[model samples]
Target: MDSNGVDEQEMKLVQGAAGYVLEDVPHLSDYILDLPTYPNPLQSNPAYSVVRQYFVDEDDTVPQKIVVHKDSPRGTHFRRAGPRQKVYFKPADVRACIVTCGGLCPGLNTVIREIVCGLHYMYGVTEVLGVNCGFSGFYSKNTVTLTPKDVSDIHKRGGTMLGTSRGGHDTSKIVDNIQDREINQVYIIGGDGTQKGASAIYKEIRRRGLKVAVAGIPKTIDNDIPVIDKSFGFDTAVEEAQRAINAAHVEATSVENGIGLVKLMGRYSGFIAMYATLASRDVDCCLIPESPFYLEGKGGLYEFIAKRLRENGHMVIVVAEGAGQDLVAESIEQQDASGNKLLKDVGLWMSLKIKEHFAKQRKMDITLKYIGTFCPLPNFNSSYLRFLKYECDWVHVSDPTYMIRAIPANASDNVYSTLLAQSAVHGAMAGYTGFISGLVNGRHTYIPFNRITEKQNKVVITDRMWARMLSSTNQPSFMNPPNGATEGAN
Candidate 1:
């Protein structure tokens, strides 16, 4: 029952020169027999009275790739996200519930708040419930009613007010809870694994012939979710990451031969590390999961570090958590509640290896300090420890791992969070089931759950962004020609 395979409703593929281009997501009407429709309450709302053409046409779709040649087909296009003139449920009959699963990220509270407010103010629908602790909350009897007053200023906070957890996903129990509670609209928020769970729930609900609308707002601090311009909180993560990079830069430049190493969160893709390093432009070397590098060689990371230090007398290195995992000896592999593979401490491993390389060189004494972060351990120093391990006595560091995600969403992310939440609510109200509220090429659209979960969006090492990062840091490509983008995610 995995959504990894395409269903007939999702076979809206267009044949172009590239061939087999997925163009649209599944609709509830495709599976549910004789679904009812009602006029959208927004048509009578005074808030939209001043607006022209507030409703998006069903035929409207956003292209996945905009920079294509004239002769090329439109390529992939997703159903645009917005309120429809016709909705599936009346305000009185709609009883909606929201659940947040997986890890914490900035703007979670904002999405929750906006969903409550959007349903209340825009559609005149009340009675929103917050599912206590993720998918398990459904059967655990963990529930709380949500109102505009309840989530009044939650947008100014970090993490989720509804609470979240990894794993604990039982499809039957969850859908049964939905059935028992008579919840017609279920809003599930989380990353890829959580989306997969959402997809499963949607399939089960459809199989049971329920009139539920399952809408997902893709949540990942990594920005690894595909079919979207970027995930929510990514801007805030990159912006907040500047603090640590600045700290590392100042620390590295303060003393002679001082090396400041920073470890960032990126389990499968190095988007965070790559974007942070690119924004700072203060890093001497950047390492990520997308581009693998060996420790010792004529043109290896060790030689690059030695040359950079010799040229500048001080340097800062940024490494993603999943970067160089193969290089770490006996790195224990594990999985979390959501089935995400646990990553070894690449920050610690890299720091020690770099120190050892310098030690064996016997050329110059280096003052190196570091920090790292882990996903499960949200405590203050857990992420810092990723940069500096216990094996080295020279570990001095700063931890912004939790600090970044725990802070209130900045202006940019706050706005983005509002759009994503409202879009999900609109889609659910419009009867779009098993779809994710995501951005495709800057336009908001409803993407199929399977389209986003099948593969993670990784950093393309051969692309211009990687080249720009290399140009910014003056770091070597690390590979003779670098590896393909499919060398696994991030």
Candidate 2:
């Protein structure tokens, strides 16, 4: 205590601390009351009066600011949503735009409908435009004005009405288009690359002293976006993948000692393959990019498949495209339009190797039937197996790639996509920018776009989920042993 019986540090203001200057934040009473109101009776609900809190910190001392610096030992850097009841722009004056980029996922149309409906019915924003062909539409003058009525039935559809593409990372052009249209908010729907572009666009808007709010809905069939618990369409993808696995199972069992090798769509992570295998429980062996597998060792995949075939007379293998990239002789570093690495045809390689192994070893006169390649390999059939019930050898390969990605969202995904779109619209209207609406631990939340694009959400091999998958398939756990050893050794 000081000599005057008071501490001097208590009187001085602590800037950027938790709960500092929160009273200075503008309130709904200051501006929202002056703006025009909507005719919707949903606004009369008692819950409308209760504003939802954004920051998880219960400390009342934190300030209400767009960005806060947390240099203290106990504080964390966080982005918080503004008061739900108030928004930065007036409803009638706001011009909102929606765009979809990156590859297609199941619930893209559903999200578009939800955003348009939310803006029209809840917020009374009448002017909404849709940008076509991804970010290129901004510069290319390809936009269509949208309405709630126009998007009413979009949720029942599959792909995005706005259409989508991969590249077009020019932030300046996008901002120029936004400013020309006097856009107040932007909703970007796609995966990590799309959100990263959104972040850049928002930064450019801020640099130009504009008040446009940018929001994103996380979309990736691969489910590889960082920090998100789940992405839209993943459930539907898994469900569709089950059908493909069943087909492979039927094909494998139809012939004697047949092996079914099914390749699912997953470039970086094996979430789709892993989840599909888990859901179906029909795959005898599941390989993902996260878990590498050897081909010729005693405990490797070759022996594993042979053992499964010997015991059950039929075997099914589920492999993500990215699982055995390292096994290929050449580099598969080429990326597609969305910057995804072109997989080195691990499925084809595995099928050929399995056939070669069985042929060279001649352990048994097994026939292999490979399907789903762009073209069948050059007339590589065996004479001994020609007279069998099936003309081919031990295995059949199929890739359920586009079939899964193009389907509509399932019941769970529809709910998830609706809430995600609603949350995205709420964030955009509340003046929250540079964030993606994401499900964090099953809670509807907005995560920073930069963080979402920071890293990929890969399956942790040490987690219990991996253990469950291993137990389900009974595949070899460690593909690469300790030390500097490589995979695919005899």
| Candidate 2 displacement at residue 244 in angstroms | 0.5
lDDT per residue as tens, model 1, 171-264: 9999999999999999999999999999889888877878889999999998899879998998998898888888877878888888888888
Span of 10 residues, lowest total lDDT, candidate 1: 481-490
**Model 2, C-alpha of 96: deviation from truth (Å):** 0.7
Clashes of each: 7, 12
TM-score of 2: 0.81
- Give the lDDT of residue 331 in candidate 2: 45
Superposed model 2: Cα runs more than 4 Å off: 1-42, 45-83, 367-398, 480-490
Runs in model 1 lying further than 4 Å from the true structure: 1-6, 12-22, 372-398, 481-490
Worst 10 residues of 2 by lDDT: 23-32
CA-RMSD of model 2: 8.5
Per-model TM-score, in order, reads: 0.91, 0.81
